[model samples]
Structure formats: structure tokens, C-alpha cells
Target: MSLEIRIAASTDAEAACNVLRRSIRECCELDHKNDPAILDAWLGNKTPQMVANWFSSPTNFSLVAVSEGVVVGVALLTGAGKLALCYLLPEARGQGAGKALLARMEEQACSWGVKALQLHSTATGKDFFAQRGYTDAGMVRSPYGVETVFYWKQLDEDTTCPNAPKRKRFCNCNSD
Candidate 1:
């Protein structure tokens, strides 16, 4: 089945939280290493309530990828140009969900006049972000003791809108 990407709503809190937790626990074995302590710390704040607050925040733009009526991916970008969250179910990887979500985030940042975006990527997501033009700024340890790669990307003045089925200028862009 095809994937549908759209803005996240407060109603999506539970499902989005589930996707985040599962993605971290199951797909990020490299980072958590099946350590219960690490897992707990990493997932401690991923509750539905916290996710609902994030979705309701005016300073954040959240997106979810849904497949077969289930949310399979979740991502959030803050107004300060921080990619706060980007997670996908193990089954959702490599199906363009991540790429689409990142592209939309970049476009939103550009619309807000943000020049650069920074994110801490787990081990499993390092290559994925790097391949999408994010460079390693450095390595940092998360609050949970997980080593994460700090990634930075400078967005172009005209960020392409990947949400469209065809590659075209975003609505606000001047058409050629």
C-alpha cells in the first residue's frame, strides 16, 4: 500500500507516540542496544500526552506518515530549526517516508526564513541523514547516554516541495 504524509494533529498523539517508541525500541537497537535503562530513558518522554502537547504547540510543525490507516512514521521540526524528532516503524523504512518527511520539514523551515536545521541522529539514522545532505557537525551524548550524531543542513532559498506528487515549486514560489 501507498503511504500518506500529512500534518499531525492532537488526535494523533497515541498513534504517533506508539510509532516513536516502537521505532526507537525496535529499529534503533544499535543505539539502545537492548539495554532496559537506555530504552526507558529514551522512551520516558514519548508518552501520548507529551506528543499531544508537541502537536498542539504553535512553534512546532509535526508530520505523520500513515499506511493502511495506521501511522507508521512521525517527525517534528521546531521553529528554531531543530529537527526534534524523526522516527519510522521498521516496516516503514526505505519506502520514501523519511525522505518525504524531511523534505517537507525543510520547506517549512524555509517558509519561516530558517536557514539551517540541526538534529541529533541515532546510529541507525546517521547514514540516512548524511545521504540526504545533512553533514555531521559533531557527536553528542543524549540525556539518556545514547551517542548521537549531530547533523546540520543548510536549506536553499527555494526549498522544493516534495509533498506534491510531481516536483514543482511550492505554492508561494514564483513560477517560471
Candidate 2:
């Protein structure tokens, strides 16, 4: 099935939260099968307020993936080029939605003049990001207390605005 990607609206908060929660559970099941405590920490304490704050942040840009009119994936960008969240429903796994969402978020970051993108990935997602050109920076403790692997990707410089001054260009050319 073809997935549609678009900027998430306020109405999408609930569905996005559901997708995130399910993704966490699925990741734990697949990658941390022997660690129940870790799984609990990863999926246990999410609240609507946190979800709302994530979507409402001025620095955040969230995209939702829809298939058959249902939200199946979500990706959020923050801290300029930082990938704050990326999740897909279990049923949507292995589909192109996750990659598409990540690509779109990278595009968004580039448009905003960000030179690099960073993210802390779960064990399940670490390999996925690595396959997409992100290099491991180090391991960090996620808010959930699970050790997440941090990754970074340097973006290509924006040459389209070569004649324009660096400060005025859409994407930072310095990071290239």
C-alpha cells in the first residue's frame, strides 16, 4: 500500500501517540525480549501531556504517515536538525513509511538551514538509521532510562543558493 505523508495536525496527536506507544512495545519485544524491566520503562509512563507538548513545541515539526486513512507512522524533528521521534505501527513495519518519514524530516531540516541531524535510537532502530547513513556518535540514556544509541548524519550543502550569502540561504552550506 502507498503511504501518504503530511504535516501532522493538532487532531493527529492522539493517533501519533498511539503509534509511538505501539512502536515502543514492538521494539521492546523484538530487541529486548529478555529484559522485561527495560520494556516496562520504555513503554510504561507516556502521558497525553507529554505527547501534546511534543507536538506543540515551537521547534518541533511532526509528520504523519497515513495508509488507508489510518495513521501508521510518525516522525518529529526538533533542536533544529535533531530527530526527536520516529515510529511506525507493527503492521506498518518493513514498509517504506519509516524511511519516507525520515527522509521528509531530513528535507524539513535542510529547508530550515540545519547542517546536520541527530537522533537517539533504540536498539531496534539503531541499525535502521545506520543503514540510512547515520553514524553512531555514542550511547545515551533515554528519558525512559533505556540506553539508546545516538547517531548523527551530516547533510549535503545547499548549492542552489550559492550566490546568496550564507546567512540568507535556506540551508546552511557550511555543514557540507
Candidate 2 per-residue lDDT over residues 63-107, each given as its tens digit = 999999999998999956789889999999898999999988887
What's the true lDDT of residue 139 in model 1?
92
Q: Write model 1 residue lDDT over 1-176, tens digit each, in one string.
A: 68898999999999999999999989999999999999999999999999999999999999999999999899999999999999998888999988989888888887777778999999999999999989899999999989999999987654443332333546876669
Candidate with maximal lDDT: 1
Reference-based TM-score of each model: 0.89, 0.82
lDDT of 2 at 35: 75
Model 1: colliding residue pairs: none
Query: Lowest-scoring 10 consecutive residues by lDDT in candidate 2?
Result: 160-169
Give Cα distance to truth, residue 69, candidate 2, Å.
Answer: 0.6
